[model samples]
Target: MSHRPRTAEAIWQAADLPARRLAGVALNPTAGTDVLLGLLACDSAAVRMTLCRDRDLPEEVVNAVLTHPDHRTRSFFAANPHIDPAQRARLVDDAHWLVRARLAQGPGFSHGRSELPEHTVVRILTTYDREHLDTLYRQVPRSARWTFPSHPEPKVRAFACDWWSELTPRERSALLADPDEEVREHALRNGRDLDPEYVERVLPDRACHARTHLLMHGALSRRVVEQVLAAPVGREDLAMIAGNPSLPLDVLALLARDPDPQVRETVAGRPELTAEQRRALATDTDSAVRTRISVHPALTEEERAAIDYRVSSDETFGRFDIPARMYDPARSRHYALSGHPLLRRRAAHDPGLPPDLVARLSCDADPGVRVLLAQNHPQAPAELLLDSFLAYTGRERWSLTTRPNFPTEDLAGYAGAADPMVRRLALLSPQTPPGTVAQLSADPDPDVRADAARHPRLSPRRLVELLDDEELAHEAAANPALPPPVLDRLVAALDG
Candidate 1:
């Protein structure tokens, strides 16, 4: 039974249609620059959000957004992940502080590659007031920090002074005497507060995390240590104190035998652990304590294997989804070949794995190993990414599709696959036919149907029918194939 397509008048007369039509058009990949430019004047918050934030804009549209009257519209573009970071970086000096802050925060989802230009970062650090500067500082990648101390920008060099404790003495001295007043001030500010006398004077009055910071990184005097040991701190604080490098050998031994398994676990990783302490912790009653000791640098492989440590197959790897710091290739290589799947999984977290190891791990029997590799490695094989996407339903599942090597060609074959999720992949393929897309628009699965509804190739007759469909109207309206006459009518009806 064939039905005639809805008239533009009928769609215009439909109840509550304007917002949906505008939203859909905003997402329509085929929406021309002129259509988008018309939309920019529509003054609907929902329309503005969808238009500015949801997809990459044309150069003309991007320019429109850059100078958009509404701050929210500009702010949304600042955080739009689909655009190049350079586009987002341009907003660093925007008139609105909120827009600049959004740019500082980077994209909402951390694929781990988005970063502001170094010049922009320097400008924000130098010119932004303290509150906004703090926001930018937190988003700065740890890998880039190494260059900060030597950067030509004084503000960047001053930024490195925040990690005063980690700097070499030579670096510290140089920064303290830096020609830039701000850089020298920052070095002095961080260095002065960590002195033993300053720590001792402030130890008793400091809060828990503040005290923990002093204990862990600040210069700790005997009085401060004694004060901390006598305080009624919780297990977390005790665990933190156990890992303090400045702790005396006697204190380290005492903490290794602490009743709390967590504190013992913390003490087990200490470099100062005596041979006897290591042996005792290896046989600790708690499995986690034993596992911690098993990886201690002092232990021989034979000794490490001798300990009955546990590695759960159900262990979550969410933290390892994105590489946070520079990984050591030597250590990653060693772990990649280890007998334990947990060790192999750890190795997969390294994004810079050698090609050979990447190939070897791609075939690992453990699902975690393959998924982690797919998530972390830049050159993860396309087949592995597709396989991982199909097999894993974790929160980060959709991220697989965004990977550089994820296959986009010849995916129409998945349209008829039994799994609805796999069917969705067909819509991703440019080669998928309009007939197949229309068929999927009526698919049993709502997700598959929704994806099909937005597909650019969907037939115009069905697209108009979907605009009147409550379930698919928003998606159908978003279809790039929605005719120019229909789009013009929908925009014209906006005032009514």
Candidate 2:
């Protein structure tokens, strides 16, 4: 006979998440407080919100509901005017949450009055959460706008940046100069384009600002970028200028002499440069600069070989994750191979490729490339991965193997593979049979043996019997789901 669930209100009542979700579609406002309390106090959120709507709930019940840790219940009690204003203000700091808020303000608004008549504005300003940005779109100056730019939270300062149109230009300038970098960056990244005068003033004067840093480093606007290039001040300042995509042919020639290969490489990649500029970069003292010319989309394959390749640049930080916003084909091109192996390692996992490109990368002799490939290629073929696993496991080693999904048939053969990394991986797979897991537990590799000992199919008695195997028992104990008494007995067995 099929088993029936007991305790209709217990955990078993809902067989799955969907059933749990459907259990409280509607709430009874007039329901007795007993049922209301049971639902509101439950771990099940559906039951809590449903019970919070009881209109006839006793004032004490409503008041107690406000103290609940759940945001929705506190929000409900906040809307219920029955809660006293003084009590609501106190709730703002309520270890739970402040339930009382402004209801008298026009449609779609809620403001909590401060204790002091005049200081309410300050209180409202202090309470704002900038991430919930839409909430501030319509509130009045006294209610939602914070006049200060130095708020402790940059997100709140970011919110203040949106109110630029309403503030005086001086106030806007003050925000641009705000000490918080994210506040300045967010303002420029999203707000209306800054006037050229403001842009110039901000870039040089606000040199410490992160947006200015990005602007000097990778600015897109032509006129603004040219100005930074003309004012070559320092290596860092020069790096910022050359990094801009708007560099001209004449400017690229000047920058190609930069002591930093990183700076010269940026100039070499610009399409705006003439053929002479490209040809000049081909022989530029820095190997990285020449590499840029060879790999540039505009270069012909014939040009790549004709230009003598020299290795000059030793860039350590050239590799980075593929930018999510890299729509330009040039942004994704990889021409300069870095000497630093770590840089090449990160580049291997970047999801920047079509499947074919990743497959081509698999042939890369760098073991780190192989490892990164196994770790990150979202579309990595199972066949290629199985072969790699078989090859590595046959060596019987433990190491920095990137997690790769292997085929089922290959997993059985891998149990005997010499590499513990490969053997441990096989034991870890969900598809491995209980018998296979048990068999692998007795393998020579301590790691593979440990995983087998901790396998869910292993009985507590069996686990207790294996207490003499220190590493296996220790690994099994790390599984918190294992019974405390069983674990305690096993640990005690160490000495016994």
Q: What are the TM-scores, per candidate, against the unseen true structure?
A: 0.81, 0.45
Best by lDDT: 1
Cα lDDT tens digits, model 1, 1-496, are 3244333345334535567668787887777788788888786666777788778888999999999988777888887878877888888889877787777776644534466777777887777776656546545666656788878888889989988767888889999999999999999889975578887777645456677677677777777667666873554666776787767778778888888899899998897888999999999999999998888868777888899898754544443544535688888998898765667888999988989999999999888998888988889999999999888877777778877899988999999999888899999987899999999999999999999998888999999999888778889888778887887777666555
Show pairs that collide, candidate 1. Answer: 24-478
Predicted structure 2: clash tally: 8
Stretches > 4 Å off in candidate 1: 1-16, 109-113, 138-157, 177-185, 192-194, 204-207, 319-325, 390-393, 407-449, 456-461, 469-471, 481-496
Best by TM-score: 1
Candidate 2 residue lDDT tens string, 44-94: 543443344323355666667767866555654433333344443334443
The TM-score measured for candidate 1 stands at 0.81
* Clash-forming residue pairs, model 2: 91-98, 92-98, 102-111, 216-240, 287-312, 396-418, 396-419, 397-419
How accurate locally is residue 349 in candidate 2, as Cα lDDT from 0 to 100? 50
